[model samples]
Target chain A: MAIAKICGTETEYGLRMLPPGDHNPVSISSLLVSSYVDEVQRQIDWDFEDESPGNDARGFSLESAMAPAVEAHLLNAVLANGSRYYVDHAHPELSTPECTDALELVRYDKAGEAILRRSMDAARRVLHEGASIVVYKNNSDGKGNSYGCHENYLMARSVPFAQIVHHVVPHFVSRQIFTGAGKIGSEARWWDRAEQAPHFQISQRADFFEEIVGLETTLKRPIVNTRDEPHADPQRYRRLHVIVGDANLSEVSTYLKVASTAIVLAMIEDGFFGEMDLTVENPVQAMHDVSADLELAKSFRLVSGRTVTALGIQWELLQLAKKYAAERGLDCVGGEERGSDALARWERTLELLEQDPSSLSRQLDWVAKLELLEAYRDRTGASWQDRRLAMLDLQYHDLRPERSLFARLDMERLTSDEDVDRAVREPPRGTRAWFRGTCLSRWPTQIVSANWDSLVFDVGSDPLRRVPMMDPLKGTADQVGALVAQAATPAELLRLLSE
Target chain B: MMPERELKKRSSASRQDEGDVAASAGAPPEAATAARQGERIKADLDDLLDEIDEVLEDNAEEFIRGYVQKGGE
Candidate 1:
């Protein structure tokens, strides 16, 4: 049986510094994060000592591959919500903590958005009247360059990486049918001819993929990223770093995106995908084709000599997932109850795509945005090449509540406002984040820094005390809530942890 | 906050139906609509476009042209 698929997401929002003094993204990105970190809680630096980005799953280390560093101007604050609000390259990135289930992932991810929104307000108060920062919960800035909304899932280190690469690519290529954040026209589009170019695409990240599988994320990007940083015991675990998805504005899109992928991963870990081969002949080409295919009828040849539409491929995967659920209970990827509900929603989503994709505008981001673009075109009789639709595309992802086109659409919500509000301040109670957050809130003055697997504490001794969290499932509010409450001090907590 | 838009869209939809009695395709046919939220968004599509047009930023094309970003992971 597969171990529990504890998962999370790291979203790097597209941002820009409006003109006045400096438009450099790095500086503005740092400012945006610092303002947020400054207001909510005392700064807790992210401990970078554990990061091993160079350690690859492909059996070789690119020692030259270095993780981004924290400079004086850049900020890397570990929030009390167990999220990392920091500057990643040029964008403000938020990494949610380990979530035991998909629903918890949604709430925490939304909390990241709310955090970014609040950061915008905080920055505006400090910036010159005309100079300000604008943030988009999106992937592209219309340039050839793109950022990422990466997903990380914990799986067995023994599960062969080759099997994961082969089985997961087809799903990643096709899942964009529902997971896309919607983009107007193609950036650095493959086809140059007017006839071959797409007016709009379902995915914002599809046009940027150039490889099927690799470790490189920014340059020569790959669909199935092989980043091997487990942030856990390496001998027992492997963290699957997925960089193919778009930064979603719709809560439904984000929910489905993470849930469906986590379920697929759980199946792979259990070897439930025995003898099932859904590999596309060319996954890179298939991803682009699926994204450009507005009619959802484009079919591509599979490695097995059968051609299947993206929707058809999803249906086959769903059928297998249902079988897996019956054979072995869905105790891994979110418990059986939530897992069953997620599968049902996945089935209904595919059915709607088959019958009439337009009917799902209220639940899918790409469809919702597509409908708005169509309405705009019908009213003004504009082409897909029109720039106004592009602005509309950008505005839909705006973080500001008043300006965000997505907020006005009344899209379906799986998490409540109260839950999102609480998620912003509090961590999910089911995971190790509860312990991390509770410690930070209780003894912010003594804690030095935090990482996924350890927390450093300054207990006023010559040496600092560090608490190691190796198991993502351990240190839950259930496990350590009372232990933390009774300690009353960092030194006492360290003593309890040692015991 | 949201009820205002819903009420306005519904009232205008009814008014358009009453006024479009002479025209065949001017108003969205009531009998042909689905009760899905999406179908309702389509039914009041005109009002949606109007609201969007009213709130859209000035000089949007230039703003989009200026929105360029660097590569990241």
Candidate 2:
């Protein structure tokens, strides 16, 4: 039996206050996250030291022994649990420890819920707390935007990186159907030929701009990850860092989202699914395509020259899942109605693929994608030119307000040099602190500050922190290929300054 | 060929095992005395078992004869 380990944490939602007399419900919810963080932190000082032997005073402890005083201090606070409330970038994020099983994962995810409820209660206790909070479970706003929904998987480094991505991407794309937090509206369809909607059945972003960088807000991208670090153990393991998923309100959906992926990954490692043949024609487009689809019928050709549609792969995996369920004596899949619906959808998608692969193929085109976007908008009765939509479009795309038309037209064309220079010289709107912030920002600041040369963060460190920035204009055909060349670990790269 | 007396003894021992199980199951509760008085079921069961065993022993020669006939057929 393959052991499954799923460890994930979500930030306490950030709040953005609406102007006086604005009746938008979402804005009210946003205000709650903003005001709640300060009140919660005032009640508990997460930076308090624990006095345990051989333990750093500032470091966190699994058990509250080192700082008995701090433990006693926490009881006086609103949150009875010793969970810390800290500033994650600009957002208040409550992180739960890595859990070993699905039930434990549920417990950790629920911890966020408890934190939110308590914060709301605390707010009610205080006078002049007028703001409401809306928690978003999305990665980006619709219209090619991006946000963070980070995933951290402890993987054995012995597995090759290429193999991990190959087996994982298709499932990552398809999993959104079950796990997608529903979205409200869409953008104007760019193409006039097709009647497809611009808005999606599942929108990654409900709100446009998020000041924070964490998973608790929204599901914008199918996966937002930085493939920078790899563990050095000879019996290698890679902690897969994933940041793209909606903050799930439904416990069952959250369980299925995390557990099913863990199982699929286990199957991949176990060679139960055989091998994923989809060599994504364009990795970035494939990612965006997966995010846009609602029915999960999108098909990509396998490396074997055969096409295994997402529906096909899911059906085969479900068969194996049935055996797993039986062996584990789990009734998780017991609901006949849901099982029937899943089966029906699975069959319907298979039929669609067999009847018309062109329907899916057309979706691959930029024009068709725009049509889908428009179709969704029409269905939702949303205007494409709405300012909220525009801001959402920019935010979801992670496009800077000042980005040139050329950069907007081709993100792959933007090189490390241009990105670095822009980040250093002009920096995007509200991003001046990316250079100084202790918390990680949405953009890779460590690489950007290094410029194209070997970046060095500190001079005295034994290993110098360096990153190779690829010249986007002159680099290879791969979009990220032109960015930065891989350098020594941050520690090694930092040591070069002293030399 | 004459069967060993030990086989007969083993059969009798298995019968005693069944009797032990039935005895250890305990008598009906006082609440069911009315139903138990009318049933007299254990006596009937014991009589049926004796009849069954007698029937088997009496038909043993004929049973062997039928087996040989079936083989011939």
Candidate 3:
């Protein structure tokens, strides 16, 4: 009944090159990305011809500088995996290819970490002695600033934006209980009524949110982002750009975050929540309040005039999800097995949240992080603001396998290293990414430039032939895997595709 | 020729880990004794702390103080 929920994630990693040589974040980020790109293949630049981040869903365009500035003097590389790895303003950002489901997203997301780790290794070899780069899959810099781990979901163009905001705001407010990569304390010191400041919060990005809906991501951040850049058929789809989440290191946390949100999107697309109101009285306050409630017992008043706990809100959503699955079958979040797994995990997570959240130390990032921090406190009796705790918080998200505290935890995993290695090189076969990636890997030297919906190939003389792949569902591995393998050159491949 | 690639289709069953997490998650909510689980968690935290001691940054306060960066969207 619902449209198949195609989704992806873009993570901007925190970059800090240790001591010695130059440690400007932007330069280090550029080095990390360009070094990795150059080591493997010819430089394949990202085409910014189609990106329209300025086109706000609220109607008129704000300013077109976000893309124009990135296009100039940026190390934007389109990966063989149909992902984009580049310097986003200052952070080294990696965006996964369009994934058909949440589970597929997990593998691709892990692959991104592998790529960044390799990038760090590559940068180290080229840098001066004692000058090394470090990357953290985290949101904030422990200062007043915060970056984003944004999720993009495809919604039917016909679905009104207001309806999306109305239905999704409450989930965004409450889902932080599990989606959060926990932090030490509030970043908004101005908003801190010091007596009431939470020592620790469930979400790293919660204090940063100040609006209910907005186009601004870095400032006056919104609970529901309104960026309307559909990198597909605009007449048929809407890309819901979500920038409120934390950069998670836990596989289960990432999985549940994407999967549950996908399920909710499916319900929204199918018009399943008929007249049911799940609105928070004030979403920005509710988002921060939910994050601050460590006891998980704070209640917020809803538009329906009933007050409910964040856990209560999640349970209500979960019940509706189960009913939607039973009635509609979860084809929207990718077939029965993956959908069922999402539903089951969602249920188990909520039940654990209510009965024993500490038990989820192995499943959720915030819980695992809290457990690690608390364990450190028990060992040394350090307060929340202790420098050791802050370092521990940042180290938990470090990208290095050996250095990453997340890697050491016995966390529940939805993907394997073997699978992640494959994902690092290959794209998921269900979408056009299969064709896009297959072409790039096979014709690496010949490809001149690439982007989300098209690939321009250099065929030695004739104008660069651009193969447009606007339909996200077409050009699957099932559809083009053999064709890609059989072709000897980009010229033949283009000819065959035309034929 | 294109490199030899494995499908590596991740199965739903792979979501289950070989840790106590999957076991406790699969167990009925009421059936898992919360108090005993709490004790086990306290015990596990002890084990985790031992591992953490080895991996923690040597100059933690200095490292954290110097870890600032330019944030982005």
Q: Which residue pairs in candidate 3 collide?
A: none
Selected candidate, larger DockQ, 2 vs 3:
3
**Best of the two (1, 2) by TM-score:** 1
Please identify which of the two predictions, 1 or 3, would achieve the higher DockQ against the true structure: 1
Q: What share of the reference contacts survives in each candidate? A: 0.67, 0.00, 0.75
Q: Which stretches of candidate 3 lie over 4 Å from their true place?
A: A20-22, A190-192, B1-44, B51-53
lDDT of 2 by residue, A293-352 (tens): 655567766556665555555565566655544454222322334333334443443454
Task: Provide per-model DockQ scores.
Answer: 0.48, 0.00, 0.47
Q: Estimate the TM-score of every prediction.
A: 0.93, 0.44, 0.92
Number of backbone clashes in candidate 1: 0
The worst-scoring run of ten residues by lDDT in candidate 2 chain A lies at: A430-439
Compared with the true structure, what per-residue lDDT tens digits does model 3 show for residues A125-147? 88888878888999998887799
Per-residue lDDT tens digits for candidate 1, residues A1-499, read 8888899999998886776234888888988988877877799877877888877888888866764453434688888888888888888899998898888899999999999999998898888787778888989887788999999999999999998998899999999999998888777656867578687899999989999888798888999888888888888999999999988878888888988998899899888888999989999999999999999999999989999999999999999999999999889977889999899999999998998898888889999999988999988998887777887889989887766888767688999999999998888787888888888888888889898888999999969887888888889999888889889789898788779
lDDT of 2 at A167: 65
Q: What is the interface RMSD, in angstroms, for predicted model 3?
A: 1.7
Query: Candidate 1, residues B1-73: lDDT per residue as tens digits?
Result: 3754665567566646744652554545544443433445776555667677555656788787788888877
The DockQ-based CAPRI class assigned to model 1 is: acceptable
How large is the i-RMS for each model, in angstroms? 1.8, 44.4, 1.7
- Measured over all alpha carbons after superposition, the RMSD of each candidate to the real structure, in angstroms, is 4.3, 28.7, 5.8
Error of 2 at A232 (Å): 13
